[model samples]
Target: MLSRTADHLFWMSRYMERAENLARLMDVTYQMSLVPQSEEKANQSWNAIITLNSLEDAFAAKYPVVNGENVLKFMVCDSDNFSSIYSCLRLARENAHAVRGTLTTEMWETINYTWLEARGRSFDQLMAGGIADYFEWVKTRSHLSRGVTVGTLLQDEAYHFIRLGTLLERADNTARILDVKYHGLDHGGEEGATDFYQWGALLRSVSAFEVYRKAYRDVITPERVAELLILRGDMPRSLLFCMNGVVKNLDLVANSLSGETARLAGLLRAQLRYGRIDDILEHGLHEWLTDFMDRIYLIGDGISRDFLVPMVEAA
Candidate 1:
């Protein structure tokens, strides 16, 4: 495959996955904002989303405050924010269009229609229609796109690249979400109602609440939630699960020049596979997640160097 085509295929799926995850983050943050809390605590919840995406500077430049209204507008519909849902969907469609011939009819149509619907949504329009409902629509559209791709596309290099992009993006977002929420909560001696609600909200954001219940058959705790999301291979959105998929897909699409990228992915997967929640917490979850994100960045850079267009050419 041409490097340009590979690049488009890879980022096309990544942007789509990113849009879905952003919706998840915003939806949960929105829900948390509705919970009764001090004004400062509510703002902190909203600000956590900004911090999770490392958009502090960008967010501050455009919005004077970090409250729900401003944050929602910035995250959901701001055209200038590259990582906003609107921008992600637009870029996903643009990339899909670049490689339209390589995609199945269903996949192209799914992506194109999603963009068409989401193209010009204003914050007021989104709020009028119901914020949570709009987010649910984004998630549903992403799910449909993935479902169609899996069902219609051939299981070839193109498919593997798409899967790789999705898994890597998912893993990165999962780690960020967990790290931000875990640290944001009060870690004092006992769990309170607020902590329980916040933790439960975090689980629901990742679609892991029910999985947590089934696996532990007990009340939600920081340790069990961490264990479920980080170590449980069966949890589809778990870090381990995402890394397992990443390693598998990287293997499928591996070339002679891609050995190092594959090795990085494999190493990360092995660590998660053999990892324990106790050790991760002992070492400090924030520090551990920081390292994980750094490694993920390296693996992404390796993938680009090995298989995708070079930085200069892409520029």
Candidate 2:
């Protein structure tokens, strides 16, 4: 396959995964905002919202008024915002369109239909039936597309690349969400009421509310939620699960390239395998999460260098 084709497939999956994550993150943010904020909670949530997506500068420039509506619109629907949910989905469809023949019929159909649905949504209409409903719709479409891609796509090199991109994106976003929760609760002293509600929102946002409830069968706590999201390998969006999936796909790709991508995969796998939950917690969650995200980006760059970029393209 041409490197260009592989690159497009990789990015196509990354963008879809990113869109789903953004929608879910926003859902959690919206719910958190609904709970009455103490001065600390307000400031923490505001800062968390800005830093979690690295949108501090963008948020300042786009919205002179830093309120919820402005933030939500900018993050979710602003066409000018490159990392917005709408923009990610648009790019996903465009990338998929570029290498149409490489994808399964169902993959193409799913993305094309998603694009068609998004194209019809005007800003006013999207914000019409409450932002919650709109977020839900986007999340549903994203989940459906992933299902279609996995169920119908062939298990070829293209499939592995797609899985690689999706898993990488998932690992990064999962880390980010955990960062938001960790930082917001790190100075935990006074905001007990808001903290509990925020904890519930965090669980629900990842669609792990029911699973977490079934497992714990008690009140939501910061430590328990962190354990569920980070250490639980069975949870689809857990850091362990995403890292494991990436290792599997990268192993296949490394075999294809005769071990070119092996070091990158090996490094990440070792970090997760050897490190314990206490290590992550005791070392300060924010710094640990920041380092994890940096490593994920390095892995992605290595993948691009070894697999996506052709000699001519590099030239």
Candidate 3:
């Protein structure tokens, strides 16, 4: 396959997945913000959100305060923020359009319509119980795109690359969300019913609440939640599950000159599969997750080198 086409196919899926995650995060944050808490505590939800998305400085420079409305604007619709939902959908559509020949008609239409719908959503609309609706729309549309691709596309290199991008992006988002929530609670230590609900809400944001219940059958706690999101293989959004997909898909995508990417994925997969959440916590979860994210970035570099379009140096 041509590197340019591969790049477009891979990134289009990734940006779609990223947009869904951002919506999920924003929905959970907005919901938590509405809970009856002290003024100071309600603001913590927005603060944690900024930190989670790594938008503290950029967000502060654009907005004077860390409130629900401003953060939602910066995350969901800010034209300047490339990681925002609007930008993700716009960029995703542009990429998908570039590879329109490679995609099914259903796949193309779903992405196009999603982007068009997203552009019409205003900040006020999202804030007034509209964010939740938009969240459902983003997730449903992304899932539809994936389903169409799976049902229509051929089993070839293009399909494998799409899987690679989707799983890799998902793994990073799941890990980062868990890391941010864990650290936020550790520092804030607002224990009680409110804290319990916040913890469960984090699980629900990733669509993991039921998985947590089935796996543990106990009340929600930070440590058990970490276990569910990090190590449980059956939890579809768990780090291990997503990394396993990367390993399996990369193996199929590997060619004579490009086995390195598969090897890296396999190594990461093994580490997580054989590893334990208790061990990670004892060693400091933040340190462990930081290392994991660094390794993920390296694997992303490997993927680009192996398959994506390369940049040429100026003479």
Span of ten consecutive residues with least summed lDDT in model 3:
306-315
lDDT of 2 by residue, 158-184 (tens): 999999899999889988887877776
- Candidate 1 ranges with C-alpha deviation above 4 Å: 186-190
Distance from true location, Cα of 111 in model 2, Å: 0.9
**Candidate 3: tens digits of C-alpha lDDT, residues 184-278:** 56665678888888888888899888878888899998889888888888888888999988888888877675787778888889989999878
Model 3, runs deviating above 4 Å: 311-315
Residue range 33-114, candidate 1, lDDT tens digits = 7778789877887888888788999999998889989999998999999999999999999999999999999999999999
Local distance difference test scores for all models: 0.89, 0.81, 0.84
Highest lDDT against the true fold, candidate: 1
Question: Candidate 3: which pairs clash?
Answer: none
Per-residue error (Å), model 3, residue 110 = 0.5
- Estimated TM-score for each candidate: 0.97, 0.92, 0.93
**Candidate 2 segments exceeding 4 Å error:** 38-40, 189-193, 255-261, 310-315
The deviation in Å at residue 277 for candidate 1 is: 0.3
Model 1, poorest ten-residue lDDT window? Answer: 182-191
